[model samples]
Each structure stands twice: as structure tokens, then as C-alpha cells.
Target: MIKKITTDDLRKMQNKEGLILQGCGGDLQEWQDGINELLANENILLDGSKFENCLSFECNGITCLLFPFEENVKLDTGKLAIWRLRSHSTFGGTWLSDYVPNRLGGYLAEQQKPDCPLIGQDGNIFNLMGIASKTLRRNGMADQATEMCERITQTAGSYYEALNIIGEYVNITSAEDADIDEDQGMVM
Candidate 1:
């Protein structure tokens, strides 16, 4: 079974530092419950309909997007894996441009190559992927990303240096700022 992000972890993130992550793929209801509980104690940005239906809280303080759905999740080792454990899920993305921040993906834009993984997939791939993300194999079949990453680093040059950002996450368990601005709650 996948190790769902712990409630205590969520609480620690929001109250102490206002950092939370969303990986919107699997049972949204489960994630929904987690956020609703958090919502009862904090100010969150969520799509009313989607939040009510899937219960995703695109919290204001979220700064990372976890990506374990790639061909080899283990490729996310080292610096990147840490970010995955803490980043927001691309599930909340409204458009391609907004999905992956330029830093992580800027190299793709420059290369102008379609890096998509082996397509021709069948059913319920994303669902299985979510399960995998919760507790994926430490090492999967994909080649180590180190070499590719190094190549990217060399290529990104000045742009990568400029775009990289150290993000923040919150795990609030207190109700001190538990009021979701009635206005920001609009399902955007």
C-alpha cells in the first residue's frame, strides 16, 4: 500500500511554515478529506466545485510539485526527490504553461524536443501512478537521471541559474489563521 502523506506531516507544514503539497491523481476524496480537515483550521485556495467534488486545496503557500509519474520515479533521486516529496502535484494545473514551472522544464523548451515517455499506454495508468508515487520502488527501470541532469545543467547555462528558486511549504495545525478568505475561495 502507498504511504499516504501523513496528516501530522500536513499539519506541521501548514501551521509552522504555511507549506502544503497536492498530487492530484488518485482518490481525490481521500486527499479531499485531508484538505477539508486542514481547511477547518487554515486559509486555503481551492476550486469550490473541484474542491467540493475532489477536495483539492491549492493552498497559497504551496511551492513545489511532486513528479513521480515519470518513466522511472527513481530518476528523482538526490536533490530532485526531496523536492518531489514536498512539491505540489501537477493535478492542480490549469494549463501546460502553468503546470511545470519553467525552471524544472525550461530545458525542455530550449531543446524543443518531445521528451514524452513510451506512449501507447492502456487503462488507469494515472491511478496506478498515484499509488506508485506514495511508495515507489527506490530504484526503478529508468536510467539514472544524473547524467541527463548534468547535460541539462551544462545546457541551461545562465537561464537555469536565474530560474531556480528555493520554494517554501506550510504545515499549519493551528486555527490562528484558519479563515479561508471568503473571496479567494472562488473556484478559479
Candidate 2:
């Protein structure tokens, strides 16, 4: 079974001194070099393997995952793709992107994780995500609040970032603090 690391999981690992890394060693370049060494040690082919491992790290008073997915370094060759997590949505974003995963079977091979991993966000981020989700629901944008939350999670660069974006759509039509009715195209 695959161990899924949620945003809540990252949150729980936080304290005063930022994120504490586990099973990771060396300075910045050395740490990266260590990861490369791990890949070489694994000797796994980049044949689009679905293998993944969560290496935890502390950063800026928060703990984040050093999540690695499988990728092809060369044609018909395989290697482990690595990232600081929280970038699941933008994984393999562009050709110039250092974290770009090799495309196989017409799709970029990436780590299978939640749409809104909330890597950089804290409880405040959670509240922002929730509010965005509720606002979307009250506006009748979608049937499932989970979907709206997922959207917020996927696009929200951070709690403040999402708040600014969602704030635009949140309209108070009356003193009752009622939200606008998107389906009827009217304010309620």
C-alpha cells in the first residue's frame, strides 16, 4: 500500500524551529547529491515505475516531504524524480524546469498524491481553503464542496494568495451576509 502524506501530516510535524528533516543528510548541494546517490543505489529503471518514498525535511519553521517519483533520465532508462513536495500539481511543469519528470506512454510520470497537498500552508491556509470551498458552494458553483476545496487546494499558492483570489468572487448581496446565486445569475 502507498503511504499518502497529506497537508495535515506536514502540519503536524511543525514546531518553533521550522521543519526538521529525517533520513536526509548533507548541506544543500550535498543533500541533493545524497539524493542522487540514493537513486544510483536503487538501480531502478525509469520504465515508468510507480514507486515512491517520502523523505521528510524541515524548512522555514515547517516540515515538508522530499517526495520522489519515477522518471526516465534517458530513452528506455529510468530514475527517481525528486522534489520538495507541495509541487505535485506543477510536477514536470516545463522542459526547462529542473524537476521535470520524463514523459512515458504520452504522460509525464509523477507522484500520485492529493490534488491539494497544502505543503506550504498552515492552519490558516486550511481555513482559507475551507472558506473558498464554502464560498464556491454557496454560489452554487459546484455540487461537491470537496471539489471546490480541491480546486482551492490546487490553485491557491498560499492562504493569503487564495484569499485574495476568492475575495473577488465573494459578494455580499444583502445585509444578511448572503452570497450571490451563481446558477440564477442573481444576487441573493
Number of colliding residue pairs in each model: 16, 7
lDDT of 1 by residue, 1-188 (tens): 22333222232232121222344545645655555444433333223311332212333444322212222222212333343344435423332233333222321211111122112223243332322222122223122223233333464455333122100111112122222332456211
List candidate 2 segments past 4 Å from native: 1-6, 9-21, 25-29, 45-65, 71-188
Full-model lDDT, candidate 2: 0.39
lDDT of 2 by residue, 108-168 (tens): 3332222222233344756656654655565454434564465567877775766555444
TM-score for every candidate vs. truth?
A: 0.19, 0.26
TM-score of 1: 0.19
Q: What is the lDDT of residue 73 in candidate 1?
A: 20
Per-model RMSD to reference: 24.6, 15.0
